[model samples]
Target: MLTALKEETYKFCHEKIALLGLLVLLVTTLYSTLTKTINKSTLIFAFGAIEWIPVIIIAVGAAFFEMEYDNKTIVMLLYKNSSKLKIYLAKFLVVFCYSIALALGAILLTFLLSLLTVPGQYHWLAYYQGHTILTNLLLNLFGAVIYCFFIVGLSFMLIMLVKANTVVICIGLVLAYFGASFSTALMHTFPTAVGILKWNPLNMIFISQQLTRGSFALKSNLTNFQLIIATVVYGIIFGLLGYYLFKRRRV
Candidate 1:
């Protein structure tokens, strides 16, 4: 499993598509640091926007296997000695690790570039984040990564159901874009939609930042415990469904 995982990790890391996502994050980080404000949370959110990079990039990685159904070549690989469970596990592990490494790498690079822009703004990176820039970045990197995997899982679930990554991505974007609009409508109003819609994975980054900055973390219309359980259950179900689909594929 170790050797297989290493090879799978290499496969994911080698993808140029993932590389572009990393580049985009680095660029966004540099851009984010230009703001004049210098609060702890501001420093956090500046680089934090980069967290969303995986939300986009991981979708591309998830597509690697499902999108291959169209190629016929990926189907050929399925006929070989590997078990479907192994393939699915290998891909999932690779994507998961790649997200962490990618996020960490970008965070470090962003931190370095950030010194020039934000310049001594991350005291909170030390206070709230365990007293070191690297440590804080690592923690956020991992948290953002789990969020990324959950997003990837969601992506695959959509693909398995719809049979097209493009369809999944499109639907996701529509849901996200309009969801933001809906959240804005509710932000000031005291209606039912007021406390919800912001916790959505699509808009989670912005909400996560709001939480970090001491603003309201996306008010859970469902309450905290309910949301946590729902998220966990959601992850487990999709992971099993994705693995089951991989196992049952006729290829």
Candidate 2:
């Protein structure tokens, strides 16, 4: 298992795709850091920075990493004494870690750079705006881990099931941005769309915004208990399905 993990990590590290993702994440972090202001204009930029980091990581991991398998390289690992389970774990682990790292890196860099560039400049925001440097850092850091895991894991599962990476990437990005909005737009016309919105990952982003601003989080009213339960159920089902697909795929 360790050997499999090491090999997978090495492969991911060497990929130009992974490097580019890291680079983009860092650049965005630096940009956000240098311009730390609170306004409607910055709101769009903030969301764009945060949203694109995960979307890019998820797209790359979903669409490109599996190319090696499609070209028969994955099968070669079997001859190297790697079990199907280990192989699946290795691949999943690499992508999962990659996603988490990119997300956290961007968030931390933004927070740190914001401090360096505009000390006490973000004071117009909510809770963190008035807090100490370490306090703000801690808040964002804790929030990042909880939120990153679910989003990245959810997208990684989708990538695992879809055979065509490019198609999945395009569709995933479209869904990433417009899915919740479209679903909400249809909620009144199509009641079932409301149910679909319950599980939409974009809701998590909205939930975070509400919580950070000291407003009522949509999930907090217990109005979303069913959605939360359904999400947990759906996540388990898909994760197992991903594992099954990886283990059973024929060369």
Candidate 3:
């Protein structure tokens, strides 16, 4: 496992697409933060810079999985690792870590931009939405961590099953942006199955919203804790299923 993880990390670091994706994420973060006219620094701090996180995650995740198949490297990886599960997990872990790194980068850049662009505008201790700016930021980041796991797992599973990077990326982007909205619409349209539909993976995307503002629970019909649990559960399910498919796939 350790060997597989090291190789995976090294490969990811050397990938041009990974570096380009990081650059794009940083640029978009800056653009999103600077373009917002709202003076609410806390809101800008938590959300503005992270607006492109899901898109980047989807793109990078698709590329990571597809690259192995495209380059015919999976045969070598399978021969070297002996354990398909280890290889799959190592790749997933590398992508998951990349997602966390993106989040941290966004947070750091948002803070620095806030300082340089609007000096004294942000108050870490100042309350916003019933919590301090710093508190809200942390909560949002925590939610983002869970979201990353869910999305990355979903991405890996989709790529393994579809074997098409473009299609996987498109599906992922749509879900990242509209999954919550679609889930809401479903619940409304089929009001009788709200209980089961509320637990759907799509609805779990609202964990961040509910965590940042308790009022969002009314819309999600779930508490922050419930959302967190559901998201984690779905993430694990996808990861296991992806591994199963990867193990059974023809080399």
Candidate 4:
């Protein structure tokens, strides 16, 4: 498994999808901080705008496997005695780790930009006087990464089911674009179902909103703990489904 992971990581690095994702985060972070008067708190929120980037990149990375299938190269990998689970896991880890790295890179770049642009205008410890800038950044980073994991899991399931990059990309973008609104509408229209709706995987896509916006988080009717649980449960479910399908798929 470690060897498989290393090889996949090497492939990911060679393909440069992770590099591209990092570059996107860099550009978006610069555009966000330079174009707007954003402080540390707001800077954290701004980077969340491009959180879908990891999903997009991960989807693209998953397509490499689809290409393997199309080219009949995956059979070679499968024939090497590596369990299908390990192969699936290697790809998933590549995407998942990349997602987390992208989020961290955004946080770092946004902070540096904030330092250069905002200077002494805003204190890093402003979010909570008790918490330092680094602490708050970690919290926001955690929030962003939780959603990234959820999206990666969703991508895994989609890649397995569709086996096409374009469809996964389209569906991912659509969900990222409107998933929050749809959930909000559902919650408002059927207030009684809010409890159940909060657990929906799509509902966790914009979890950063809930993390940053106190009022909105309250309105979400889901405590941060519940949201975390929902994200983890959804990730696990999608990962299992993807692996199950991949194990039985004709390569």
Candidate 5:
């Protein structure tokens, strides 16, 4: 497992897209910070830079698998690492680490931007959305991490099923952008079944909002704990399905 992990990490580090993704995150965050007028630094600090995270996660995850197939290196990988489970897990771990790194990078960049642009406008201890600014930021980062897992799992499954990176990315982007709204529409459209529908994976996308907005629970019909659990469960399910397909696929 450790050897597989090291090999996966080495491959990811050598991917040009990996570095490009990081650069894009920093540049977008910087642009967003500079363009927005300073009102509440806490809001800017927490969300200003993370708007593109999901998009990047989807693209990166899909591209990782796509590259292997495109380069016809998956057969070599399978031959080298006798354990399919280790290869799948190592790839997932690398992507998860990339997601966390992106989240941390966004947070760090946003923090520095906030300090530089409006040093005294907000206090870290100041309460916002029923928690201190620092707490909200931490929770937001946590929510982002959870969402990353969900996306990676779903992306892997889609890639295995469709064998197309573009399709996976498109579906992921649509879900990332419209999933919450779609859930809301579902709740209203089928008011009688909300109790069941509210637990759907689409609804889990609102985990970030529920974490930061005190009133979001009422709107999402799910507590933060429930959303977190549901999201992780869905991630695991998708990941397992993807692995099953991968194991059965002809190399």
Candidate 6:
């Protein structure tokens, strides 16, 4: 397992396209941050741009698996004693770790840049009163990480099933962004199915937004606890399904 993980990580790290994606994330984040006010709220908003990070990582994950199949490398790995489960999980873990690291790096960079560029505008105290800045920021970051896992894991599951990088990435992004909005609107229209609709994985994508800002919940009936639980359940389901499918794949 350890050897498989190291091999997966090394492949991801060495990919020029993957490195370019990270560079794009950093550049775009910096540009977006500088355009807005440099404060606690703005810092969070800047990192919110990281919603696209998972999409790039999803492509990476799909490519990681597809390349092996294309080159018939899976045969070599099996002969060298690597189990299907180990390779599958190693790819998943690498993609998952990249998603989390990209999020953290973007958030931290935004905070530091905000401090350096506009120290006078740093309003951590006013933005989140009664709670220390660190506490509020940490809680918010935790929620963001949870959402990241949902998207990354869901993408992993889809890629495994579809085995097409572009199709999976496109479908995943649409679901991640528009799925919740449309579902919430429909739930409002029907009003009776809110209970079941709220549990949809796509609808739970905005869990972090609802967590950090009370105003974000004005349109929805879901509580933070419900969203958190739904996110966890969906993440686990996606992960398990991916593992099952990979284990059963012919190649």
User: Model 2: how far is 66 from its true place, Å?
Assistant: 0.9
For residues 50-82, write the lDDT of model 6, one tens digit per residue.
465655666666677777777798778777755
lDDT of 2 by residue, 117-224 (tens): 555665534444455434444444334334444544555566666677676667657756775566455454665555564555445443323323444333332233
Stretches > 4 Å off in candidate 1 = 1-4, 34-39, 121-140, 174-218, 221-229
Candidate 4: C-alpha lDDT: 0.71
TM for candidate 3 is 0.94
lDDT of 4 by residue, 73-149 (tens): 78888888468888888887887787777766766676677677777877666655346665656666677677667
Backbone clash count for every predicted candidate, in the order shown = 0, 0, 0, 0, 0, 0
Better of 3 and 5 by lDDT: 5
Give every collision pair in model 1: none
lDDT for each candidate structure: 0.57, 0.57, 0.80, 0.71, 0.82, 0.71
For every candidate in turn, the CA RMSD to the true structure comes to 4.4, 4.5, 1.6, 2.4, 1.6, 2.6
Worst window of 10 by summed lDDT in candidate 4: 46-55
**Could you estimate the TM-score for every candidate?**
0.72, 0.71, 0.94, 0.88, 0.94, 0.85
The local lDDT score (0 to 100) that residue 150 gets in candidate 4 is 71
**Candidate 3 residue-wise lDDT at 204:** 78
Worst 10 residues of 1 by lDDT: 207-216
Cα-based lDDT at residue 208, candidate 4: 60
lDDT of 5 by residue, 99-179 (tens): 899888877876787788788888878887678887888788788788889888888888888889888878877887798
